[model samples]
Target: MQIRRVLAATSAAVIAATGLVACSSDSSDSASGDSESSEQDGPIRVGTTDAAKKAWAVLEEQAEAAGLDIEIENFADYSTPNQALEQGQLDTNNFQHLKFLAEYNVGNDSDLTPIVATEIIPLALFWKDHDSLDGIEGESIAIPNDPSNQGRAINVLVQADLITLKEEGLVTPTPADIDTEASKVQITPVDAAQTPSAYGEGTPAIINNSFLDRAGIDPNLAVFQDDPNSPEAEPYINAFVVRAEDADNETIKKLAELWHSPEVQAAVDEDAKGTSVQVERTQEELQEILDRLEEAERNS
Candidate 1:
């Protein structure tokens, strides 16, 4: 997140060069030291985009029992939490997966680190008025159109043997990757959030767990889903992230521990309602996946 401050200052300089007045701030010095005090007397500000406050009540209670003040800040957008963490506004965030964090770091030239692996929310293929994949063989299927999720949608289809990507080991595959002649379903790329509503007779779609929850759709209705235990699911595994310097911090480590406890696991299960699988990938394995993702990002 050191790079956030640098980018801001760089923008200010550019504005000044263009004969524009630039606002200034005196908090840069203090921002750099904020993470160091996350576990001190002050409360630890945890960032998340999901139902962390509602789903992780036991985590809060456990942290309180351990004398650690916890503040869960729920974000509507995925990008802001990382920006906040980088600028020292948050001690750590728990919303994004390895590939997402890797892309953020690569795009911003920062060294944000993933300290723990949490759960793998599978993007499942669901259909309306159809019970099986074969019933919707020649139908048009909708998938997310975004760069990050589009590949994920395609992967689900590929696993179902409905389509095949032209290249293997793609981190983010667009519709271009699909081999049209070989594919059984006609791939229709739509907004990720729109996939849930796109389903009907002769129409199937890949729906992400988050969006499906928001739309009140049941994931049990899915015809196909990616295997969470497979190595291919590594990139989509979510984690707790922090600035690289605070990777060894005791508070963050304890928080990760509390997340994997039985109470928290029960909460995750209750909240997910069988939509996602809870994963307990080790810290070393997480870093290895992150490194591999970062390498792939750089090459891309």
Candidate 2:
């Protein structure tokens, strides 16, 4: 895949650039307190887990050409970016999907909002021993144990016709929801980081895209994946998020829209290794999805 080619050619460059910023320290001071007054005070601090990706550099260049200054802060893990943004340390972040954001918002009593849709990096089912879903029956599959990804992994199995859920239309179904008597395979929930290892252990696994590169798994080798364009996949769409008060800020909105620029999008496509399916949802539509997810989280 193109991801392999990019990694081989620019792994060193990526590593070097990755050192540019560590995760920002937590602060008791709420940065959101002064957000409105300081909206244009300095470079728009945009937090991301993929700061080393070529797309950020291209995005910076494009934003500069358009008279907007953006500073990309790299976070080592998934939990910090929104925290940084909520605390007023960052003007925006572009690392998580709507479901993840909803969980964070509902859990923390925060109102970080999605400004625009970016792309969906598909969660795919990989099997080392089986060439197709038909090759496995009454066998076990490993899925992510985290709330956000586990539900999606279960949905992937359902989509592949390997499992049947007891009820339909669940936003985040768990293994307990599966009808074991009717299903083709049982599931073993494991840490998201262990899915590739589970695959190596000769069990079929549904792996997240972020773990694929480091595990030396080719995305194209996956036997099945959820459809990114489907209505069921809306919650998984990643976006550039900001504090709710700044959702309509012209500069931040423009910065979010800049992700669709040809140069930036091309760079994103290369960095994603062709797993990213581009999505273009209006801000209102994105918020609608987020609201539904937040409601689901509250109910869950």
- Candidate 1, poorest ten consecutive residues by summed lDDT: 1-10
Write one digit per residue (lDDT tens) for candidate 1, span 1-300: 001111122232343356421122422433354555444334566777774434567777777776666666666666767877787656678988888888899999988998888899887888876667776777789888877788888888888988877887676777888888888888888988788779743468888788877888777888889988888888999999988877867777787778887788887887778666888877788999989988988997
lDDT per prediction?
A: 0.75, 0.82
Clashes of 1: 0
- Give the Cα-based TM-score of candidate 1 against the true structure: 0.85
Best by TM-score: 2
| Candidate 2, 278-299: lDDT as tens digits | 8999999999999999998998
Candidate 1: where is the Cα deviation over 4 Å?
1-41, 200-202
lDDT of 1: 0.75
Q: How many residue pairs clash in each candidate?
A: 0, 2
